[model samples]
Target: MGYKQRISLLMLIDSLIVLVSVVFSYWLLSPTLYLAPAVVGISSVTLFIGHHIFAHVFKLYKRVWQYASINELLSITTAVSLSIMTLAFVQLLSFQTVYSRTLLVTWMLHILLIGASRFSWRLYRDTKMQSDKNKKRTLIIGAGNGGTLVARQLLNSGTSELYPVAFVDDDVTKRDLTIMGIQVIGNTKDIEKVVVEKNIEHIIIAIPSLIKCELNDIFSKCAVTKVKTQIMPSVEDIMSGRVSVNAIRDVQVEDLLGRAPVKLDNKKIADYLTGKTILVTGAGGSIGSEVCRQVAKFHPKAIILLGHGENSIYSIDMELSTITDGIVIKPEIADVQDKQRIQTLIEKYEPDVVYHAAAHKHVPLMEKNPHEAVKNNVIGTKNVAEAADEAGVTAFVMVSTDKAVNPTSVMGATKRIAEMLVQHMDMISETKFVAVRFGNVLGSRGSVIPLFKKQIEAGGPITVTHPDMTRYFMTIPEASRLVIQAGAIAKGGETFVLDMGEPVKIVDLAKNLIRLSGLTEEDIPIQFTGMRPGEKLFEELLSENEVHSEQIYPMIYRGKTPPVNVNVLYDLIEKSHHLDKGELKDLVLDIAHFKTKYLTQLSLVE
Candidate 1:
């Protein structure tokens, strides 16, 4: 309705209500209907003026009545009560006497009529929306504030897909209680039962504060029901205006994994990162780009995007550029293996911190091309570390893979050597050099999740390397944030490992993805391909000397790396050029898998 029309309508309704209330009040209290015409007339005018004045004061005309709540009711009460009180005061002045009974009667009528007029609009809308047959019946898990917020928003939205039918909370006190007209039916244990009884078509996991194990358990229960389930948008996201409260999203593999992220100490991270010039190698790659994004959050003085691929470098440069208004973003297309180019860029940028994320990480690919792996993962790290050392960089954090521990694959061995190079550099250089070791970042360029998703899209036979193969998985953001966090805590020569929860079986991961796509095992059959060459049945996050992911305090555990045999390392680096693939693999394995002890033992035997 137009503003003027709405105001005129409200004014007319209130005026008529005032007339009826005062006249009816006078008739009930006085002996005759005409006993006090002048008093009745006076009371009507006073009530009308007082009500409109209070209504204006409370912004009653501006209120959206169809979404009315207690606040709107309170405004109506205040306006009606004040209008009645003003009538009594005016009666005393004009007639030299006040009719108390008449005034009380008029007060009750005014409140009832005005409050009903406003709230009835909300009542009608709620009733119409509640009867919507098109909306899916939704069951909310968690009757706490988060759940209540979701219910309220869903109830208010006319075109929402889900209708909140019931809430299931673990809190005993909330059971059998009503919130926003929806009852809390039962606890989490009875979720399956509630779904059957309520005929729920959808579910919302409203509690984000639930521990990872608890979340996994709840999701497991939800998964069994075969009903589509989603998670509520985070309160942080809602408050930040990134999404609304009703912006629920489909469950992801990350949610099923249910690993709590490490809380970073922003103060410590900011101390090293904020306002400092930072450089990220392999800036176009998954982890490297995320590192740049996380580093930007610290308000860096500038970020240098160094990578071999121009497309990737340009893409990240544009992304970082759009997000970081004040911070300088420089995209440099230079391969990390180019020692002089790396040195030139480091000198040109004069970065305070360098995150070396460039590496040949794919196992099968690296196994076939061992020389390329050495050139990129090994030499690339060397060039970057040496340049950082020569340029007097404050800290250098090399992103290492968990495969590096007790290495089996060519990629693993190469990464292990890369870690060794940084640890070796740390000993002599003034700059603190450290490496962050992690396993299988989900959604990375070559991770299994992307592969499984593609297979599902292609409609069939999801290939699993081995039914028994397992690996630790963490989100890209988690890995990047912790990588940055590792830089903040770097004390030189320490290998930082994230407390990745228990590893997931590869077949089980495939099954979860299938289910997530709303497909059954019958829809997508699992095919067990024999284990790929140089691939392990499972990957390790740390060496025997390091504490496990669970034992680490604050999710980051650092182990002191033993010094590498410089002679043996140099020998492998020098002799690697002429050796064939088999000979090179055996030689790199000797250094990476067994370290100095076996090579020294082999030398004695020779």
Candidate 2:
């Protein structure tokens, strides 16, 4: 039955218990039949009616049995007390009533007994729900307020089905104590023994306020146990009073590497994109699609999806169409390198802002085909920026990468050149040109996440570039949303670098992914495949030459870089028309290194 029906049944049982108590008290108070049957019956009926009325008013039946708290018990007690007082007044008014103080005292005792019985039943049911024979035996890693909160939620939720057997706290005083009926096994040093002796299936980290080093240490302990792990969200999230059992999610690969969540300012992002028409180039690609999704939420006037790939464009168009019914989402299949086509689209749509996300981003692939990367990323960016400027667009944003900062790879070099082009264009154009640069997006195609997941699912060795190789990572949607926000906040010629939480070691990431998939490192072995050509062991967001300052948005920082000569850059780009592949590559490499080489080359070539 539903909760309300069950609660009604319990109330009926309580009334019967009260009636029995009253009879027993009356028998003891008077040996003879002094009280009239009609008066006694009337009093009993009045008490039942009063309880029903007060219970309804207090919403007692509405409380979920599993989630019942002390507050609910207090409400129940208040309702019963009020009902008893009303019964007492009724007995005084009736002349035929044998008003015995003993009977009244019995009624109050009965109320306490009945209330406690119902509460105990609810607690028993909640505890029983976690008694699945095959349920995971979990060990919580903290004993603070946050940990206790998590424990209470888990015991009450009746979902998730995780059974908490013990808590591991570093505090010596709490080492032998019990919380919520579970024993505190020991400090961090006893993690291995606790896991082995208790047959722990999982380790739940309940320390939301833990620092990076402490978290890393806990993760190390968890790794030795070879148990699956989960983590509670931040303390602020819990303190904001929105924390729930569902907030505890599987520990991500990023957490083990000591990465914290990035803080973002919502107001700054909302101000720039809301109520504006935005055009995103490469709208079907990983980054572009994410940008489109994020932009749609800001209630933009319209979003034009412009990309060369018809299938990719159509897929995102269909997805956005389902979500953004009221907002205008127009998809156009056109390459950014086609200046005439790009100019035509921009003029026709008259977008307020443009995000040029189209690019060849893979390092090894771009290295083999530098000409393609240059043509698409470098030249394509130029076409889009120039067209947006000509069409009187307010802002032009280019999606860039960490590889662009002191790059050793062709992809990185091309992106750097693209940044240079935008900086140069911004000087002479009315349009505000800006670039947003960051490191790899997790789960995007060509990213390591999906690749490792696929390999592990296939029951084979997970491949890593090297044991020490590391890279900065951000989720695709998070990265894209920040990109949209950054675009809106751009004034002119600012390269906004997003704050990627931390650099994750590739080997460690693979291992965590294995455990999260319900497997061990032994089952899914990691193979160290040496680094690829032009790929770096680590990635940097900004070079030593660049200095940064906080922008209006917390997540975004503006880089201080030398400006490019507009006239000279324009002339050199125009001259690039006559150069062959080899000459173009040489020209791009030379131009990318100098602060004003493009300007000098343009003047000389022109």
Candidate 3:
């Protein structure tokens, strides 16, 4: 019906309900055939006027009864009770002839009659909208608040093809309970059996707070069942009101990381970044781009994105432009290794803080081509640090890796050299030059997580270097936040190390990725190909020689870097371009003094 018509129809229904209640109450109070018609008329008119006034004030007629909830029912009760109470006051003062019990009866009858009338449509609509046939039977994994909300939203939505059939919760107390009419069937371990017995076609993991290991277990069970699985948004997203439980999305490998989302000191981070012109070298890469995105949240005056890849730089620049306002985004296409180019950019922008993240970081590739590793990681870092020093930047933070400690790969050695250069410069320069070291980032361009996902998608053997190999991992945002936090706490020359939780075994990581992809290890076999060239069995955060001291900021520490041989490092960097591949590798190791430690550990054969 039309808007005005619908409103009028509701009003008529309410008026009739009020009149019936009045007549019913009058008959109940005076059954001796001495009924007063004038009394009934006056009571009916008073009730109708009072109720309509309150109803209009409450905007009762504006609600769609086909989707009525608890709030709607409460509204009806309040309107009816208020109207009857006003009528009762009037009867006591002006109409003492009528019984007081008559007003009480009318109040109860009015609420029941009016509430039923409003909800009848909702009951009918729900019945008409739902059907068991031809709909996909869906199971919700959590029976807690998130899962309850998902079930409630789905039951009321009436638009989806998926129907919630049951809930699977691990809590023993919640197992026998029902949420929104869906019974909690069993724990995650019984998922496969439940899916088979219930003919479930889809499953939604509604536990936003599920950790990685728990998620991996649930996903493994779901993978065995071969049912399509989806997940709710992260707890952070939900708490921030960015999304709701109904925002079900495809499960990503990142979700399998299972680490609680990093919580940073926003005010401290913002204070350090606000109104500052910051420079991010290698801003197109995963970590660099994330740093830019997080830094943009602080309302910086300008963010200079310097990277060798023009396309990556353009993508980040455009993305930030849409989300941030009044902040200048300067995407410069230049290599960090080009000292003159970097010098020119720093001179032009005069950035207050510089984050140098450009480096060739893939272990296998860097081991094969140590020249590029040195040229990019070592030389590029020297160029950026010197430029930042020359510009008198307040704080300069260079991104380093865990591999840089007790180094094995050429990539690690080059990063170590870069750290030395920054530390050496910190001693004399006015700028607070520091290096932030952390372990492998989960979703970086060359990370093994992406490779495992692709292998799982391709339906074949997932490759791993060694079954026992382990590496510390953190999300790009977590790593980025720590890096920014490091800059905030940087005093010069200290190599700040991020507290990457426990190291994860590569085999287990691969297995979790397989499970997250809705496939078990048997479906996509994990093949141990043995360790590659310069690959280590485990990665360490701090070297044996480097002593660490805790900082005020949690998950961040200051490590004592070995003194840099300034003259020798400068000579090595100067001769680096002319040296052969073998000579360059030797030169890089000599500069970092890592030649002896890694000499016996180099396993070139893959």
439-491: candidate 1 lDDT, tens digit per residue = 89999999989899999999979999888999999999999988999889887
A best-first ranking of the candidates according to their lDDT comes to 1, 3, 2
Candidate 3 lands at a TM-score of 0.88
lDDT of each: 0.86, 0.79, 0.84
Using lDDT as the yardstick, the better of models 2 and 3 is 3
Clashing pairs in 1: none
Rate residue 389 of model 1 by lDDT.
Answer: 96
Error of 3 at 585 (Å): 2.9
Off by over 4 Å in 3: 23-40, 88-95, 100-105, 134-144, 165-203, 207-228, 239-246, 549-552, 590-606
Judged by lDDT relative to the true structure, which candidate is superior, 1 or 2? 1
TM-score of each: 0.95, 0.84, 0.88
Better of 1 and 2 by TM-score: 1
lDDT of 2 by residue, 512-568 (tens): 788767788889999988999778998988776675655556666778466665466
- Write down the lDDT that model 2 would get: 0.79
Q: Give the TM-score of candidate 1.
A: 0.95
Q: Per-residue error at 556 for model 2, in Å? A: 4.0
Clashing residue pairs in candidate 3, if any?
Answer: 212-258
